[model samples]
Target: MINDIALGPQNREVKQYLSRSTRDSVLGDLGKVLAPQIKGRGTLQSTFDKHCIKDSSSHRKYWTEESFFNHVRGSYSTNVISGATIALLWKSFYFYAYHPFPLDLHRDAQIDFDAFIRATLLIVSQCDELLGTRELDWYWRQDTAFFRKASFVRMFRSIAAPDHKSRSQQQVDMTSSLSDAMDVLVMIGPQFMHAMPSEPQLESVARKLFVEGPPVAGGQVVRREDLSALIRLLLRLRLKERIWGTRCHFGNLVEAESGEEYLTEVLVDTLTGDNSGQIVTFQQLTGAIDLIPNLLLRFQQLWAVLFQPSDAIDKTKPQVNEMELNSIGGIVSLFVPPIDDDSAGILRFNQRDTRLTLEATTQVSPDSLDTSMSRLSRGISDDSSAYVVIFTDDASTSNTVIGAFFPIPSKTTHMIFQIQPRFRILRWEKTELSRLNLIKPDAKASLSEFAASEGSLSSNNAPYWIGNPLEQGAGLWVDPNKGTATLINTVGGCYTEMPSVGGTSNTGENWDVTIQQARMHIFTVRGSGDRKG
Candidate 1:
């Protein structure tokens, strides 16, 4: 009747074969042979030879006791039982003896708890055979012995070692063991949560495994140092599966895309939500933060190896040097925000302009100045106009202003653009005039002529004022004699040589020629582009 309950569509054929009288008889006989070994009264070798070895009448003459033993020890042996046969036997045993199968069997037959325990013991005793045969389901079920105090430590050690297994086989065993461990935790998690406060034994085991350390076997000593190593091993296995394999478990909560993502989600949820119910401490929280840099460094090292540049020096060498490691360490250190202090220099200039340097020294707070003035007593010597530009610390240009000190004359006024809060004048340079016609015969007509025509300077200075020089769009023109010429279409802002009525050469009623100095460009502008006025 129990066999009537289907395992799945995939197992239908195996289920039918298992239900046959002949196969059932064989399984019963196999159980009889294993019962002695499970009870510790008989050897595993004798049990294996009785159940696993083929009859002499059969054509399989290679299935000898010695050959089966070699296969169990992870040696290459073609005489071992087929994987399908092993799976069928394991499922039959689980259904018949392991009382409460992990999945419901929908059977009315009473379960024999003693028989189930013995069956599990037998399975664990033959773990080597199961692992070598890649019987993952059976291996997983046997890990339930983790609850048995006498066997848990031994199981832990067994899972930790791969011995002579190949890399691929080792990975399979580690993943299977990890999954089983998580399943055991899930099975016990609810009971532990409900009774942990009152149960000292459970609490003691928890503290030993997670907090303190596991008890060492065959000695009175407890190994505290092995805690991290054990955790590292588990993490490495979980990470390998999540990173390279398609599916993996994150505790018993949910399947995750990757271990990294699972970790990130857990950390975010733990920190962001009300965690009064969670078993976390302040020390543990800070300890996790402290581990970030180290984790990042390790990840960087792995990434460097995984995604190494094709053109890297010494392509044959896979090892990273100390300098490279330190570089990665430095990158990891950036996770912590650096301390800010006013005592340290805020800005440093590697290259300096003598003129701006002179101006910086004269002002009490040159750095705080909103606007700077530079008086060009003789105006620009060349035909090109100068430009002052400010740049943020990130090297992006923040502000640009045409240098107004142009059209050689007795004196010219230039006003620097307002310096923004976090920006500084990076450089200034001579830029070609956007409007070369600013000095053309018609454009350069005297302000006196305009004043005479307009009746008074006060009535209308707009007619004599030249607006943005690059209004027509300026660009660079290559000249054979002069390397390049920056041409502009208009004069910089408005300018007039006409002195105020009651003003001296230095001071005026509304305009000062001497004291009210204009800021000149601090750096040179090179290359070519159109300057639109």
Candidate 2:
């Protein structure tokens, strides 16, 4: 025998008891204060109210037509929504719109919560135009009543609003979208090695990211408009699937109303991998995509062992601003990555966050790049977060470098030790960005320093944090006053290469580039050790 779930009269008592227990556990001292009267003294009855069972007004299973339409912005009146409008919310509420309607009944059709949700899953992910007719036939055979309901809804809406046909028809045409015809092929671009989505297909779906580019050049080289569009879409998809977290996590990244835009610009700039103001070659696009996994954008992590209402803004406020929603702790997010194995070594007590800005300089910090690490981190409430240091260069040179120091900050020594990430040094020779990290034990110095001496960065009474460079190790030394960086360390240590690069420092295999003009930035990660409450 299967167990019932608060249904039937038999299991009703169990559900009522469960609900009472749940309420008692959460009510704390308040439960005692207002206990008797609310609980009812004589012959109290349990009600299976929809509001009582669900927390959200628009919960997929619990919502009525009226509540759900109001929950979704732009959904407008209940049962007055079109498929195109529902499609717009697919990213945020895919589950809500994909379970009710599963076929192309009619474009101008007015749909209830049931039809929109079913149609969504069918259109976006599971769509296979090759099998369309057969599947429709199968679905019609499976549920003839469902088809009848859909047809009646469409017929009624058409009769009520005669003008809907012209307006809705132009909103989503085959030429403007990846729909109705040959499906499942719009996303698999050439970079992923699937059948490359046609240029027409790309222009149809992702033309927004394009910058009104020049005419087509020739083979392999596409119009500036097309390349930009393709790159942005690829970057957006990878980030949605890889770097950015769930819709629930988006609110935490914001510091202000424009916080999401600030973070989005940072993410988009980082993925572009080019700021020379030139069209990124096909090679650059692929290289940037390949680098996504290794390119980690992190910050000093904030850990909350317990949650409190005051810790977040007053969510109950009648008009909760964008900053308050989708938030954790006090800070609302724009796009925060999930905490997982990829976070860092040391468990970090916190991790690191590094981002790019809109200007040529990918180095601008959200805060300011002051002289002292402690001073830079002074304003950050969460002790485990990273320091911000932005450095922008001109259009002449090409390299962009971002680095952070990870470890629990020592109040005693005031020193920062390298823990999670190995050293990363990037060189922009012309129009490309390349990286070099020295992790192998055999990585020794290649004598590129003529005016400078050899050894390592000083561990003496320096005010800010510095990595203790090995005699054979490499390090990036930033001199804020000069706005220039040396090929190898001019003060002490010389530059070394990654061990995986296959040649030794003394073997004459080289990496560092001498820049005529340069700017530097250093972001140090400080753990909230004594600060962790």
Candidate 3:
């Protein structure tokens, strides 16, 4: 019956509908026409020869882009395209069985539809692992569900016949090859939405596909990368669907404490803009979060660390602070109370934000060592010097010779700093000005007297911590690998070999920052609440 499916001439129809230059290029390459002999060698072979997949010589030439369209197109009428689409969905669903995703997601791993479908089928046919077996079975059963829904009938009804006069001609416009494939998915959605096979039905399909082959042994193993890719695809589609509406709601906020500090956040849509949202102060955010899922737990951990108060804030400076929240990978949604009187009440957690505190940290050591500590702040320096200030051993790290201050001071301050690694301190510039002013807390000192004293208001000495090419830390470090400064940072508190911030390496192994002259930019993932800055 696929032969009965009357898709128009392949070449003419395909060129007219190519969505991107990449697709057109692929088709152009296919048009040049290569012999089967060249195509046959692309198949991968196993070392032990146990899984040597001998390329079916006939199928080898079909690797071209045009060939792909022809295969699916030819299979259109016979229910083969629908069947294959279901197969793809089944295979895609296997990702959920082995690798769970956020419930709100709409796309599967392997953002590339062809690659995803091909990989799923190949894995089902070859992989003997548990994950593989479960995947194959999952897809096979999904195929059966399509039959129960009678989706083909529904699709045909909606589609216009070639010569028929119809009012809804726009509805069945499968003019492009891509449209044809999408049509198949549109028809197959109902089957995928159904429950998995019952015992009897499972037995039925198992017997039918027995000739095709058995499933892999351990089921499907979905890796984190796969999950990330899948989530990205779904996010793109959700954006396409315009699912993100204004007035997003972040679910309940969860408060967590690390040592003496507290960090908190409520699950909100990842797309919400911090600058655009309602400005909620630190006082309002203290008891706002609610714990719901394991995802929220992981999210809370990251938020706690990212929001920890930093030592870089100078109580002297005033600036309009903003907060940015991003998912580790994709845009995820959280439920919040409905905003209006709509019958169906649910919250969309797109990018939503409120005013919150920005925290920074600074580390201090004894001045005898001539060592510098990196301070995290909102400001930048071209020389990449650490903002180091020497004090009489009594002042808090917050007191400095030069600092950014505000007209109206706030109770707490957060400053951030980035360290540019070099082997030694190339130079140093220091200045001391007497009669510096002070802005000490709970002080009655007049403006001029406060400026003259050595108290918190004093700004007599100005020192710039310059990069020392020879000065190195005790930990691991490296300069640019392949001309790029090598930098290192941890992931989820776990060490993994990643590209050197300034170097090039395949393995993401951790490198010591002090030992190597690598100019690495380090990022800390953390969260913070309003109190105890």
TM-score of each: 0.16, 0.30, 0.19
Q: Give the TM-score of candidate 1.
A: 0.16
Regions of model 3 farther than 4 Å from truth: 1-243, 246-515, 520-533
Q: Quick one: RMSD of model 1? A: 29.5
Misplaced by over 4 Å in model 1 are 1-199, 204-243, 246-326, 329-533
lDDT tens string, model 3, 301-339? 222221112221222133233112222111112101101
Model 1, 1-533: lDDT tens digits are 45434334424433343333232243243344334333223332343333343446853322332332343234112232234323222332333243111222222222233433333433332321222111122222333222221122222232121234245534543333333323322222222211211223322332333222221111111122222222222222111111111111111101122232232333333222224232222212222222221232222222222212222223233223211111111211212111111110101101111110001112122331112111111122233533222212211221221222222221122322112221011111233233232322123444334323523322222211222333222211112122111222222223222111111111122211111112222222211111122
lDDT of 2 by residue, 1-533 (tens): 23333234434432332223321131221222212212111211111121122436655333333332343322123233333333323221322132111222232323342333222222221121111122122221233333222322221111121122334333422122222121212212112122233446434433321122321111121123332322222122111101111111111222222222233333334333325232322223323211222221211111000001122322322222111221111110111111112111122212222221111112324332333222223322233443323232442333333332222222211111111012222211122111112111121432122112322333111222123334232333444344443233222233322111111113244333332233333333212222122
lDDT score of residue 81 within candidate 1:
29
lDDT of each: 0.24, 0.24, 0.21
TM-score sort, best first: 2, 3, 1
